[model samples]
Target: MSVTTTSRMRHLLTYAAFVAPAVLFFTMVILVPFMRAILFSFQDWNGISSDIRWAGWSNYTKMMSDTGFLKSFSFTIKYVLATTILLNVVGLLLALVLNLALKTRDFLRTAFFLPYVIGPVIIGFIWQFIITRLFSEVGKATGWVLFQKNWLSLPDYAFWSLIIVTIWHSAGYFMVIYLAALQGVPKDMLEAAEMDGAGRLKRFWHVVLPLIRPAMTINLFLAISSGFKGFDLNFALTKGGPFGTTESLAYHIYLDAFTKNLFTYASAKAVLFFLVLASITLVQVAVMKRREVEM
Candidate 1:
């Protein structure tokens, strides 16, 4: 081979070596399972039986007529809205605070992010105990009747509890993302704004927010997707109790596939859920991308 041809072949080999592992991993884990799910969504498999009958749209039809499925769908939407808003708001506030020149800024950031580092399963169990048992004692001691009730036992309270837990877990994560974006905001611009007699509120509204729109886009997408797909925390906290009021789409999928053994139906629900999340995320990205202003 000529020298140029030999160099090109070497580069190709190097590139293939670098990409092969990731390509193989994705094909085995993600692509295979995704393809299986699509196939299963059209079948009547009980998750165990060898007789996999092709059911076509029957699973989708059954899901539409199922009231429990509809309730879970609505509950998932409520959870998504509440948790997304709260996560972004709290995360932005925390980011703003940490952006300041505090003495313990690094320590405080680590402390806030500690909850996020804990496994979701452990966080769920920890919060479940605290909300159910520990809060009762504290309430009795402090004479706060609001905390005296079974928090996880009541539908409304349980819903809020889930929101609070999700926010507590995720806010720090998004805060870190926002903090990085905030750090990128030009100090000269902020100083000029201050020199022009702009108040802190005005500067943040006109200067900081517009510059940090990219981070907001990312944080919003993360919050919305994670909120809609939340399962472990809700499962551990309430298990969709209080007359199945807290059941989300994810938990419903779990119940259908595992608990009820309706694997094919659950696959259909999963496919629909995936499509809804994808559409919403795409729309959000398109709208937010337009709003992003270069710093």
Candidate 2:
């Protein structure tokens, strides 16, 4: 009844008008499904059938003995490590080069980033054709021993092939992030470092790196998460081939849920996957945040 109460009520309604849609969207799309998945992880159900059964801890316990699941997890960890390191290194290098004032700088940036615009599935298919078809043709024409080898048919090669494709697809994205960070580094700082008798490498190591720590944190986080959740390329390119050496955890989860019809078991694996990813990323952010320079 009072003017103060009426004004407060109006402000609350205005705030709710802006926030309500996002809250509802998150609840329906993410929160609800997440809770449902937790519930499903405790029950056995064919994805299509109505005959659901309570599974308790059986699904989670079974993972301890599942060799294929274990292998996929191991492979995923390796994939994450390889991709994260290579993506960051290659991306940073590309960023450094592209950041330079070259004549074709803008054009080169666009060319490099063009791959990231394509979907992983499409990139996989494209590279699949290139590796399997075009490479062989080129090899025969040029007598190139390197191209003659079947990159996708051998276990080690297949693993590296996946890493190569992942880096090709994503490196430009990471490069853009690093480029922005690099550009943000003060020119005066570099000049000051030079004036202090620091060489190029020393200047970059001491001045540039410390300044770009925020971007490094962001790029590292993206690389780790993207590496862990890698599936589309695995599905479209190799399909976990060459004795399943390149089967990522996400792909394995897909196999269990869709191919094996072990929905509850897959849900359990997904839950564990979430926990592991969350823990690793949290630790990464915490550690990186500590090292980040305020400037």
Candidate 3:
């Protein structure tokens, strides 16, 4: 009833008002689904059946013995590594180029980032058509053998094609991140390096890289996570085709739950996939944080 108590009550009400909507939404969507997924991982739910019987660790045991799942898991790791490295490298290069004084830098930045604005499903369809149709035509016209083979039909080619498309789509977005970080570098330090006879490459290697380590950390994390969890583009482009060689873990999870109606087994795979991602991300963050502190 006093002035302090009334002010405290009003602040509490304001906090509740802001937090209530998000809490309700999270419970309805993320928290509920996550809890249900954990339960389903231990059951024998066929995704459509009314009877759900607890099967203990049968799903996890089966997952370990499943050759297809193992193959997909391996493929996912390869994709993640390839895509992460390429995305970061290409993004950094683009950012460096754009950092130079150029009349078309803004235009180029928009052009590069435009692909990322498109939905992944749409990008997949566009790239699928280009690889299938345009590449063959261009090859015929130019006598180039770049598109001689069916890009989406061959396993190795399809895998690399997906990687290329993913990099093309994502590099620009990361470039923007790197560009912001690059702009934040102390210009006086760069000027000092130049005065000290540090050539461009030397400057980048010694001065620029250490200063941009924070951006590198963030960019690497995003690229790795996105690469590991990539699904829609693969679905549209390869659909785990050419004898299932292109099947990623995410696609495998979708297939198990939706296509095969093995919800419980899919849930187990999802849980395992989440743990793998978490472990890798945590290690990466710790290493990067240590490096940042050293810098």
| Best candidate according to TM-score | 3
After superposing candidate 1 on the true structure, give the runs of residues whose Cα lies further than 4 Å from its correct spot. Answer: 293-295
Q: How would you order the candidates by lDDT, starting with the best? A: 2, 3, 1
Q: What lDDT tens digits, residue by residue, belong to model 3 across residues 56-94?
A: 999999988899999999999999999989999999999
**Whole-model lDDT values for every prediction:** 0.92, 0.93, 0.93
TM-score of each: 0.97, 0.96, 0.98
Error of 1 at 43 (Å): 1.1
What clash pairs does model 2 have? none
Clashing pairs in 3: none
Which numbered prediction scores highest in lDDT against the true structure? 2
| TM-score: model 3 vs. ground truth | 0.98
Candidate 2 regions exceeding 4 Å error are: 293-295
lDDT of 2 by residue, 13-110 (tens): 99999999999999999999888889999999988899999999988999999999999999999999999999999999999999899999999899
